[model samples]
Target: MATTASSAVTASLTSVTLEVADPDAAHRFYSAFGVDTRIHLRASETPSSGFRGFALALTVSGPATVDAFVDAAVAAGATVLKPAAKSMWGYGGVVQAPDGTIWKVATSAKKDNGPATREIDETVLLLGVADVKATKEFYVGQGLTVARSFGGKYTEFAAGPSSPVKLALYKHRGLAKDLGVAADGSGSHRIALGGTGSAFTDPDGFVWEA
Candidate 1:
């Protein structure tokens, strides 16, 4: 018997993130596709001597090429927050996403004696809201369980396995307002905030994580 003309349906796939105002919306869309999620804590609360900052750990081919890529990202869709500049310790620059998440792109400052190389880096995304409880519930219903709870005023939900992108909720007026900075939906830049995690603001006037 001759095989029928049953052509396989092949589609080009380019995976990109969806930036939605409501976390619940994002959760529902991804969950329907059966996507797994996981949360990763900061590499360390007390980073090593040369660990620098844990904002966004994107490893680029070289420091010079970092800014060019960041610029391209901005031109494509990302919102450029901090222009690419050589960090204090050396390496690359930090840029912000349209959703206000920082992207720290850089090359390895440590010596590479072995063939082992790093590819994908971790980036911690901050989700801000007026009410912490309400926000947490929104993520929960979407199938993302709280991986870490700060108790005081923050909780993180995992996005995917091995990805350190955190969905955090924080108080609006606690740190940003306290610093005498007005909320313009993106907060007043980023603050170390005296902790293992970095500080970030949301599109709204709410504080959370980076």
Candidate 2:
């Protein structure tokens, strides 16, 4: 029910960051998703921020559509962490970005909508937070519009219905566990999100840049 208000404290998402070893190669790979995102370059030998802690969700037409897009992503230099499959929520697959970020391309429900074009549709950068309800409340206070949400579990926020990239938060341990990694440990998540603030850190330590 929260909406972006007029106050300056209202933080709006601008771009999300992808930390990669090679910016150029990462650019080429992510270009397949058809979204322009920010990239932060790191040493080539630097290790990945293990467990992903977050995921980029691509909402498409249906199951087959998800498969086709997942295929495209694999062809674009991604590693198939999980193959396309169906779940109660819908059908989706997990892929590790060339830079080691996890992504989930899926549909909300079942249908025979076929495949999508070369370009992907709406993308949601989901952050795995320690507490979804508190994180949701924090962002709501920061002036983001909560397009849809459920307390203590998940939150989806955007500028509007057609907004291309939305910022969301899910229960962190659940997310890491879902991605097949242990839900404990600390490391720079290697992701950045643009928002209006004095550059605050979330409950789970995800940093938002002003």
Candidate 3:
């Protein structure tokens, strides 16, 4: 029996929501992060009673970390909802972006020994190739910008105005050997760069952006 499209789509699932503290500031910050800041606001003003404080909530690592994040957000034009401090749950306090989004950054009390899921906050795509130099040059020629490099084995590329999209290049043979799939110059993967660009494999078994 042929597989249904819904089943296939369900097999490949990912979810992410962008929350901001101040609507205007959040829009600006996200725009700099390479996201198009054109989403229509559902609502903005604080409700008379329900869900007071902060527009959006973010789960942070801890109080200090949340504080640092708040500082960065403020520097990036976000407004503070509450200062980072100790939470009643022994974690950290919450932060509000200018858009009224709340970020809850806290430390996990116990380690999770379960399925590993991708972080929605950031998504990185890996591309395998034999020659890193040539791959980098190809992207540079195609109007993309190179940001950083992990030695000659790998290089990072810019996907946004402030954020970066990683185009990791591992040894083609190493990747092929590791993935148990031979490099046939036809296999493919899709990387949604949050509006920056998508990466795909080329006929020469190299990855390119579109």
Candidate 4:
């Protein structure tokens, strides 16, 4: 029998590369933020403004770890988008990196179980799409299994064991509101996704490559 698209693993995101104007400065910021190993950087002069239609989220073990990352990022020249605090979902904060990447460091646990640690539980690349349902279907057709979905609002894909980052979808304007930015942008996304399949662009213009 022919393998079904849902059962076949055609694409698996393995790495996230951000194109920045200054890789050296970005490297210094990421190193101080303690996530230098989780992402790749490249030099580019793409003219992008407002919201970039995406955000990189760091899931940590507890509130303490979230605070640790937020503090370090702020100390490394990152601008605070949202101050870390307890919310209905958990504790987290948002920061804009020097390279213009928005990062959200969060934890489901409302309280710390122990001292803060540098360990990151998961790294999620959230793409803001014009149509969540359509984009979800496009990725499903690309052989990415849906790990979780909420009607037409949001969807999360199961990352393969070897993949370094998880993928998720959110509505464009909603994502901008969540990230505390205006939903207006032009030019390149300045981001590339390294994956396990042939190169393709998603409905929202996210580029993925093998």
The prediction achieving the highest TM-score against the true structure is: 4
Give candidate 3 misplaced runs (Cα > 4 Å).
Answer: 1-119, 161-165, 177-210
Residue lDDT tens for model 4, 1-210 = 112224445567889999999999999999999989889999999788878899999999999899999999999999999999999999999999999999999999998889999899999999999999899898888878887788678888878878778998999999999888899998889899988777899988999977
Could you tell me which 10 consecutive residues in candidate 3 have the lowest summed lDDT?
4-13
Q: What TM-score fits each model?
A: 0.36, 0.82, 0.33, 0.94
lDDT of 4: 0.90
Per-residue CA lDDT of candidate 3, range 1-210, in tens? 111111111111122233323456556665542233222232233222322211222333444444554565667655544455544454433443444333433434223344322222333344566576687666555445565666556665554434322334455655444333334443122112232335554434433333
> What RMSD value applies to candidate 2?
3.6
Q: What is the lDDT of residue 18 in candidate 1?
A: 32
Under the 3 Å rule for N, CA and C atoms, how many clashes does model 1 have?
A: 1
| Candidate 4 collision pairs | none
lDDT of 4 at 30: 98
Backbone clash count for every predicted candidate, in the order shown: 1, 2, 24, 0
Single out the weakest 10-residue window by summed lDDT for candidate 1.
7-16
